[model samples]
Target: MTVASAVPRLLIVAVSARRQDRRARLSQEIAGMIERLGGAFLKAGQLLATRVDLVGAELAAALGRLHDDVKPMSTRQALLTVTTAFETVPAGIEAAVWTPPVASGSIACVYRACHDGTDVALKVRRPDVARRFAADIAIVAFLTRAAAKLPMLRRVPLVEIADQVGMSLAAQLDFSREVEHLRRLRTDLADLPDIVVPAVLDELSSGGVIAMEYVHGLDRAAADKLPAETKEAGLSRLVGAVYHMLFVDGFIHVDLHQGNVYFRADGTVVILDAGFMFRLSDMARTRFTQFFAGMIRGDGEFCADILLSTVRHVEKGADVSAFRRDVTDLVARSTGAVAKDFELAAFSVELFDLQRRNRLFAESEFVFPLLCLLSLEGAVRRLHPLMDFQLEAAPHVMHGLLLTDAAVT
Candidate 1:
């Protein structure tokens, strides 16, 4: 009887090892497959990387490469896509000054054009990119349904999450939406003069092709070389602007990775790639604002309340009192670190893990912005780590909260 019991214990150990190895292999394969499955798969890889709590560290590590490493679509195909989008090369692009694509990616390529007597960046969608996005999203839907049957995974609103991913990708594939995103964000930042959102060249822009005035300047690499004082000031303005967008406007870019943002000599911050933007619902905005305020104040109880309100589908029979206690402890423990070497990026990662362990299901739309904030933190750290993001952001965030005082939960 003892020997038989030992056999089951050994088998359990063996099975766990096998599962770990299988997950590692699957993660690496997905890293490889994403490049081949270029369109929506590439986008989905980014979202998956953010959910280390759900997907595990091995998979997150593999999918992290999709950030800036995807294979660019060939130039020939990109030009053909542009031709398709415009029906024909317009007069200025047809002239002696058509430069090759300045940048290319799975969904689109950007070319510099002097069209309509204006220097512009013409963004052209990849051929059949929409169809590829649809296919990839279908696969996500299938997997979500299959996974939802499990008791642990069932806490996640898998179907709703998959639908959210699909909608985000669909919006991205529509270049027109990017123009609107740029326009709206520009308006939101009108009070902040140091921020430079691209000027949309409306007359030349169309469905799959958008022509925006091309502003030439330093990218992230050059920005890193700036004198410390200049970089710190610019970082402050950038952080403050982002806080305003997230809290006040409620519409913000979901992809603000270092490569997609740049800084100029005059301490002006320039941002690109507004295709993947997130708009918070009324409840999400209020909850997030409360949580952010609580974090800054080191108010554990307030944060716990907001955390519970923000998450969806809390498992039945869960100990609600215990959950609040755990969240409160997390906040209290982090207070010392926040006063010392507080990195919001790392904290967000920990928060995601905490929420997952506590069976709090945050939807993709909500989870994604936290990751976006993490990315912003990464970018800002590279620029100036010593700058106090909370101090810089407090004014904008407080103003936003006051405006929405009626919605506070």
Candidate 2:
């Protein structure tokens, strides 16, 4: 609207800017503003949470709760959504019905329903979420450009990174696209018995509604009192899946936080929410392989070079030498002369800190490193504490380094 009307919005943002020290207060205020604005702001809130490398742990943790899905509409709204997608809300509705949602979140919510004596999870996309998210994207892009004028953000390349954030959110909002992601991951891990992906009911899937084989397994909460060994087994399966994704297939499941990966009674790993999947480019994969190889051999210089090169793509005018030194020191502290003595999670946290310090934190597009590092390390610590992830991933890394004839261009 008019500049006179825009004054209030700018004033609110200015008020938020003034409270930099009170992170929680700032985060809540910003999240409220975004929620009220009702579109791109929510997406921006979620994106802000994912950047632990740039925002630091506390702020990131606070923003991480911004759900991507909107509050569910009334039964009338649900019927309208279904009717809009398919001429009627199904003629045989009396024969099969869905129960109210058991869990809800930012992008969509889950409801248990039955058809032909078989149970399924009906995930419905929030009406108007896409429109609202698109609005927030515009706002965030404007903010990113505005932020770039500052000296500190010049090191971080905020604008390009923000574009990445927008793309990631767009992918999440489209249920039809997400179904394809689930299908591809299912195909990739078909041979692996320990992992499970819900079977998509293609006939029932549309842009707004997705029906899939319901996972009848214990969530992390139900398994809380179980034996340490039980938890370890669950974690092991998760770690194995991540290892295969990051090292073997070069296809990553981008988001593997507790809720996304479930544990069956038999200890199988069922991965959900594949919207953020990422594939590594051949050249980037090669460089990462070199970086891992250097880590295995305890070669600081090679490791430093690889890390610096990775940053150069997403960040400009960064102090490569200083970043390299920081990485070298972290590697030295995290590992011993022998790779077997290393701890993956501890080492990963140190690297996360390094990214924040070097201003080479997570980018929306170039997010493979963060996904791989966090999921792999988190999975290892949760599963087999004794299994050295670095040592296990090292051999694969070394092989890639040896196989690729390309230089680090």
Candidate 3:
């Protein structure tokens, strides 16, 4: 069914599922609908899965299934798209040898192949995905514009949010951008011994295709079966690498979904899929690092002030002082808490809810970093539940501060 028709049905589902138990069923229905839509809608569902605050934890968990569970296109269609990606097919690789897609998502399908004795993975963009996504985005933008006219939605900046989501989705359509992101991540994390970013085969890659070294690491479930020490070590490397990206390099892989991360028996981590990445400006990076630093030191006032600095526009008559006080209290209470004790998801929900209640909307730049951490928390919790998040972040926070000071001097 078209989204236009689906909307009214979705509204009826929402109204009927007022009870908590029914909401879980509603979440599943919504996710199934998104999967059927299968373009920008799938991407949107994956993103919404990160915001446990905006969507309740149950719905967010339901939507999170969209990350890796979508059905794949047929082998025939996948092969055709790969062949069309290049003017001349690369030597030693033919349709007969190409295996059915080992992994699939809304935008692309990945097939495993061997070229010149080297195993490589071919990521081919789905046929007509760009046009489909564009059409879907246009529809969303139109709906958002119409919704913004209502008094309740007037304060939400729905049009701007829709535009940003559209641009981000559009960027993922260009495989060359993912190639660039993978290369940069490889360089940035080169110092970390246990982390792996697969090498891209530049000669075989194009706008619609990515040919990269085929990594054969275990998925999250398989990795969980490994020894406890191995899991902890691999997870530590993963967390540290993320810290380096956020605080040191300021370039982050925002999509840390289960499908994108893998682990090996030797405690090595393999990170894949760089299509959804974000970079922070130097100012934004410094401000966020400073905020974390303040949180570490239990200085709620400092953290509150840092958050205020990142606000794009404050609502008229907003109670700025009260907002500051509440933020400060939150930081104080959360100080020194370990991952098991302090859930970033819960903390973020409360923090964002406070901002919404106080009408203090921070810039997306600042919010994105927190979301990155929230996304990472899933893997972190599964791998190392007892980790002291604040304690672990101290060193990287210090390094970030040092970098900021050096820049000023």
Which RMSD values do the candidates have, in order? Answer: 8.1, 6.8, 4.0
Q: Give the winner by lDDT.
A: 3
lDDT of 3 by residue, 1-409 (tens): 6767778877777788767657877888888888888888887687677555557778877887677667777766666776777788886445623556777788888777778888888888887788889999898899899998987556555677678757867888888888999999999999988899999999888757788998886564566698989888888888888888989989988777667788888778999889878888898899988988998899999998998998888889888998998999899889998776788867877776677668886656755677678777766665687888877788988998999999999
* Structure candidate 1, residue pairs in collision: none
Ranking by lDDT: 3, 1, 2
Candidate 3 Cα RMSD after full superposition onto the native fold (Å): 4.0
The TM-score measured for candidate 3 stands at: 0.85
Scored by Cα lDDT, where does model 2 land? 0.63
Displacement of residue 15 (Cα, Å) in model 3 is 16
CA lDDT scores, all candidates in order: 0.71, 0.63, 0.80
Q: After superposition, how far is residue 186 of candidate 1 from its true place, in Å?
A: 1.1
Segments of candidate 3 deviating more than 4 angstroms? 2-31, 44-65, 96-98, 142-158, 314-316
lDDT tens digits by residue: candidate 1, 161-192: 67886788788988878889988977888889
Clashing residue pairs in candidate 3, if any? none
